[model samples]
Target: MADPTDLNLPEEREHVYKQQNDDVPASSLNSTPSSSWWSSLLAASGLVSPLDFAFVLFSVVYIFFLGKFAFPPQSDDPSKDPPVFKAEGIMVKTGPAFGAVLGLALPIAYIFHGVLEGDQEGIEAAVPHVFLLASQAFMDGVAYSDRFSTPIRVFMPVFFSAKKIFTLMDWVGNEFSKVCVGGGCDAAAERRVLLGRGLAVANLVFWSLDLFC
Candidate 1:
């Protein structure tokens, strides 16, 4: 017979190898291939890439055209209407949490904005009427009128005024720097930034003026 010691050594080595093979199954051997397959599917579906610059450009043009075509009746004086206008109800469907926050907050923004527009130094005691009317219109637009409680709309404008004031500070700072550096700057940058500042200031002024008006 073969040497007994050599025969036993082969058997021990074979047992160790078998245990290792059992621990690592054949299905786990090609994990990379499966991952690559999923990645390929995503790429083929065009879902993995960011929106191209061309697509963004097209979308902006499309919205501009749509706005011009669809909202003509709403604009007897589009020239005076706010450039940043948005119907509050349209935003309600964006998400429940956001809708709730905005729904709660917008009436306040309107109130503060209305009071300030009237030239009040702060919220006048009588601004709630206009705030309620505006809030009702906004809720009517969104089809979510049931969500508006009377107290929420009554106090909403103060919150909105605070928010607007916060955003206005950035506009003020930027415009002030541009004006400070004045030296016959070209029409495009100067005109655009100047116009932007004017609009910002005008918006705040109008809102504030409404308090007295």
Candidate 2:
């Protein structure tokens, strides 16, 4: 006996339909938790590159080597020998600053820029030198500790710098190839290529001089 218009059936049906749609299915809710957690874990793992892992491994080995072999007997004074080369004033201040810029800042900037530009070759070329330089810095710190002798302190830099020269050579070659590629690139790309080449050459020169001089 109810009038269809008075019943407002369309509106009532729409409200019911919306309520059904709004109710989340238990299976969907249950499925998302495990999948999301796994996805987050994978994302985190992907962020750490192989170079980073290598750097960490190298640091551990380098430190272990220093502790096990580089260290002198407890009775023997490690500091008995005179310091190999002492830095005073400007050399002490500017030396570390220059090293930090070349080793840490420049490579990091180049790596980030390469990532943004999708330059995989450039990134690959720069990464080895970055990690090697970082490892050198780590070993240098370890060498400076009182447990190591003067000779060990001197040896660390000389050895690492020699290794770094080879890395720089590879980097320079990679950048040079990029710059000279047959098809011409855009202005921004050209500028980046030139800058990268120049930086690589500069590092090559600097490290060569550091190792030999």
Local accuracy of candidate 1 as per-residue lDDT tens digits, 1-213: 121111111011122232346565322321223223322332344322243223323433543454446333243422222322122433222322232223223323433453445423122221222222222222222211122222222223332344344334544554555552365656654554455455446544544432222
lDDT of 1 at 177: 57
| Highest-scoring model, TM-score | 2
Off by over 4 Å in 2: 1-81, 89-93, 179-183
Q: What is the C-alpha lDDT of each candidate?
A: 0.32, 0.57
Model 1 ranges off by over 4 Å: 1-144, 179-181, 210-213
Q: Compose the digit string of candidate 2's lDDT tens values, residues 110-152.
A: 8789889988788778876766665555455555444665555
State which candidate has the highest lDDT: 2
* Cα displacement (Å) at residue 85, model 2: 1.6
Task: State every prediction's TM-score relative to the real structure.
Answer: 0.30, 0.64
Positional deviation of residue 113's Cα in model 1 after best superposition, in angstroms: 26
